[model samples]
Target: QQQVKQSPQSLIVQKGGISIINCAYENTAFDYFPWYQQFPGKGPALLIAIRPDVSEKKEGRFTISFNKSAKQFSLHIMDSQPGDSATYFCAATGNQGGKLIFGQGTELSVKP
Candidate 1:
């Protein structure tokens, strides 16, 4: 199972509020979990990532939580701002050396 399931296809949050997005994977071989953020008309950029060894990782206002046992991971954005509005995607890759499997994107709209 190489699929990554994401939830809350769309989300709206007020400025300074917290934004949460969740994802789950079925592949146990997956070792790398990465989250990407994309703006309109732009390519997705690496936001944050965590390995199965790490339970959680944070960068700036972005944080990624990993649960290897549950085959799940999530992204949390603290102090969400209108400028933070964008689409986010969670992806996983295994040691088999294939393309990363991506989850359905979540559209986030942060209101001021």
Candidate 2:
């Protein structure tokens, strides 16, 4: 299996603090990278993403920082909230195969 490595299996952040999760892949063919947020008993949904050509993308308090050469990316949540607690997954997809490769999920907790 093409593996995407993730760090800090779990993370704890205080409300209003920042939450960050990172992932790295070795596949050079992967072009699309997206971060998904999954709440308990719910399916994961796209949170933020960036192409290899872009260095960063931000929406609201969420940001995706990409490094093409390093084949790595990260998700940053500014001013995290208790409601932001969820499982985050980093995924990569290539055009040729159309398979989405996911990193080990990161569990984030925002303490009130």
Candidate 3:
């Protein structure tokens, strides 16, 4: 089990609203969890991450809530803004391979 699947292929949220996306994985061996944010024509950058050891992790307006037992995780954006519109990806990596398995991709748009 080394695959992670994400949903909603795309999402639209009003400015100052909350944006939520979900993801699930099958590999329990994964130890590293990370989210990447990418803008149009730009490479994805590490936005935030959480390990199975922690139930949740947050940074600024970005938050990652994870459920290890359920093999699921989600990303939440608070006070979403037009500037925050971008493609979000959920990924996981095991100690054996530093390489990350990413979700298909989720496009988030915050309308002003």
Please provide TM-scores, in order, for all candidate models, with all chains considered together. 0.96, 0.95, 0.97
Q: Determine which window of 10 residues in candidate 2 has minimal summed lDDT.
A: 94-103
Tens-digit lDDT string for candidate 3 (30-54): 8888999999999999999999999
Global CA lDDT of candidate 2, please? 0.91
lDDT for 30 (candidate 2): 86
Candidate 3 residue runs with Cα over 4 Å from true position: none
**Cα lDDT of model 1 by residue, 19-70, tens digit:** 9999999988899999999999999998988889999999999999988888
- TM for candidate 2 is 0.95
Which residue runs does candidate 2 get wrong by more than 4 Å? Answer: none
Question: After aligning candidate 3 to the native by TM-score, how far in Å is the CA of 10 from where it should be?
Answer: 0.4
lDDT values, one for every candidate = 0.93, 0.91, 0.93
**96 in model 3: Cα distance from truth in Å?**
2.1
